[model samples]
Target: MAAFLEAVPARIRTLGAYQPGKSIRQAEQESGVSCIKLASNENPYGPSPLAVAAMQRELAGVNFYPDQDSLDLRAALATYAGVQPEQVLPTAGSSDLILLLLRLLLGPGSNAVGGDLSFFLYRIMTKSVGGTLKQVPMVNHAYDLDAIAAAIDHNTRVVLLANPNNPTGTLFTADEFERFLDKVPARVVVALDEAYSDYAEEFAVRRNVVWSRAFDYVRQGRNVLVLRTFSKAHGLAAVRCGWGAGPAELIGMLAKLRTLFSVSSVAQAAALAALGDLEHIHKSAIANAEGEAALSHALAEAGYPGVPTWGNFIFVETGEPALEVAAKLEKQGVIVRPMKAWGAPTAIRVSIGTSAQNELFLTAFRKVMPAH
Candidate 1:
């Protein structure tokens, strides 16, 4: 029986599970202090007050199942992204949607292309669905679109590029994406993972520039999907609501595989309200941008090189092994994400928090690496 178990599909047997950041409570348990967690790029500001209020309103009807189609939320997202409601497919979160797309698009003998140091989940999902993971090495901590374009081959079924990539906090400009789009083959689906799009400086979540144009590719019969999430800006990571914008045919295929009622009634309600509250989203964006700038300046002044970031985080090259530095910071109640899993051994990716939390992280970082 043991030998039989070991003979499972080669894809499943060799696959590595996705490793998320340690929770603040876990950090506190390990360090014996109330920790400041700038690890996962979760919004430190809790969900918008409007979203919380809406969730409370829906609590009275907990017995009822949510609309499986996510009609209201999808409609709201369409309005938010300036697309028709048919183009939007809301899900439990972006992670689930990503897996769903991978399952629908790629399988054994196929491959998905993404940056080596971008989100690691893409590789995990691709491999889990029996697809080869083709990683193009990033140039100077940013997604090298030309290299990624060059890596695509005949077996490639999909291409996942995270604009304002995670862990690195680096972004692709509109022109860069245009150049890549001109070269990308029409046969494969290109997914621009814009989970942190709301946190960007120039491009707010609206119908403008590369963002709107990316979906236009889908509308023009090109296979492209733009992934977005409410987790970051809405601060609804707990609620776990997100969505995708793409061609109706592609979205419909993913929808067939999407788990019915995966999103709870409360989550749908909360996310609906979150989408409507643009003022609150604006405030959160401002806070993240300011926090990122302050952290970047501080890192520079302290003689540490940090990546130029448009998202709500800073990726710092710590010179020492990031895991060791992160472990040391853990002892001081600071939990920043180590990028070893993403093939960055000497870098720590810190999410933007409130001013007080940022100060705590900076203080801990200084203590961990003294002026030398």
Candidate 2:
């Protein structure tokens, strides 16, 4: 090992980097075919038109530094989320806020608790700070809230959870979350990641499932942080803007530790614009619901029934090695996420795309997936 490598912390040396889904360009290059990527759970409809105009308008200001506090964007998010502006902290993305929280609360002797197979970032961020992440085993592909609460101990500094969780698209009800929150110690901060909250909320209304009450907790002065992002339904993934709302004091502390100008001027402007475009978000949700239903029905007919999903993705068992299945689909110009890293070698998580993209995926899937 190099001398510099020897000096590096063991946690830093052993940490595994996050593996993102394959991009369209990468897939096209490897397969020699044009591809539609459904692996990343991005909005196929693209960013809000208002957001595009905002970004274009903000282009001339790139030469200047962004507002260090992101005051305007935070105020917009506060209005949208029904929180006070002082209680909101804007970051580059929700992932960045996750890191900031861990750095503030976790240390060598501390730990965080989260469900196994939840968002991969909770584990990565906790470990990155030399803190342990107790991944309580999930039940039926959903978060086992009771098990997660039981896993928390005196040294546990944070609890990480994602509503309509990534990879699985499973969510707990508002009532369930309330009960779980009651069990958590006041000393431990709960970071409720609502990255897919918009989709989940729409699904909740149609399916009669209760959506998360994270913001409610924040309003009630609970020791919790609600994290949301513009990367998903808003289609601002490229710009990378997100925020965390919690107690005013906690938000103030995180704001102090936040990197200067972390959110670019363009990103801030785009997110602000996206926040006002309720029509685009609603349209995206309606399309996602329809695509999810169509894909689920089609997959079930083709012998691949998937878990009921609240987010814009479905977790389906392929009954074969997932990586092999994913590779085969890639060759047919479709891309999806294999769940091997999350421990289900026979499952793949497919993001709901636009009608045309979804059809393209189904065609490729039918060709690659053997008939039962």
Candidate 3:
């Protein structure tokens, strides 16, 4: 019998698919309760009011196709990113951009240097192309820039770093990045995935260390790309709109590879509207910071002090198996994420939910793990 699975590439066949946190609907079905989703690092506040209005208005045009070139959205994004329209490419969330970058850079005999503890998408995307993923171990849940620099060799074509990295929520400061950038070869493209950077602050703090810094390097023709999205701070996760800024030539190449009309018209409209509503983003940031602090305080009192987080999530150490602990919380309608997929079986990464959601999760934690 002919089998499609048998024909799959050896590398992809062996690789496990990327695992997202359990969806709210899926959790509700299992527990027969309204589940509080603290699994995926989603904004609890939801999308901006203006974005909602824009998407609603755009629904009438759904029968027609989206703007294939996405010119208007690109122009708006360029203004927001402080770059020229030719240098920014809108994508279907940052993940899409990540896949596109991986598709372009990786092929036979090519490899990328990345941290083992950073975003797992890099691992999946690299191997899907049969390219080697050189994973450098992290130090203190942050990118060990020195280790990443050391890992790059002759075959290294790309270096993937997660700014304010996921699962751990650690950050690589601007100064640390400049030092690392100095060490990287000119030929290697450094892909900085800064999806959570928006939550790190109010979109700007001109310290020469920012997504704009990478944008500056891009304009200078350096091989660099900064990946980000509306999903995090803007509360537009379901819209799936994201973007990247880089050299015009590089942006041209990515634009070429991007599927026609891949980003929906509604998403583009929503993103444009959301960009104008910075106040909503600021409120969401404040809520996330407060929720994270509350969670951290509870954990510290329980003797499980979590590592510092710059993003809207915290990594909590459970003295027992994290998966089991997460399961216990799930039974109580609390859905937090276990870190096994990120290589830490004894830790869980809980997204900062609303005040009520966080309290529910904290109460469930007390019932499940009970302090000593």
Q: What is the TM-score of each candidate against the true structure?
A: 0.95, 0.98, 0.95
User: Which portions of model 3 miss their true places by more than 4 Å?
Assistant: 202-212
> Which candidate should be chosen as best, given TM-score against the real structure?
2
Window of ten residues with lowest summed lDDT in model 2: 209-218
lDDT of model 2, residue 171? 88
True-structure lDDT of candidate 2 = 0.91
Locate the minimum summed-lDDT window of 10 residues in model 1: 203-212
Tell me the tens digit of each residue's lDDT in model 3 across 1-372: 259788877887788898889998998898888888998899999889999999999999999999977888899988877789998999999999988888888887999999887787788889888898998888888788998999999999899988888878887777678889999998898998888876776323423335336566766767789888999889999999999998888888888899888899999999999989989988898777778778889878878888888788898878788889888899999999898777888999899889899899888888888676
lDDT of 1 at 343: 91
Query: What is candidate 3's TM-score against the reference?
Result: 0.95
Pairing residues by index, what is the TM-score of model 2? Answer: 0.98
Candidate 1 regions exceeding 4 Å error are: 1-7, 202-212
Clash pairs, candidate 2, are: none
Q: Choose 2 or 3, whichever is better by TM-score.
A: 2
lDDT ranking of the models: 2, 3, 1
What RMSD, rounded to one decimal, does every model reach? Answer: 2.3, 1.0, 2.1
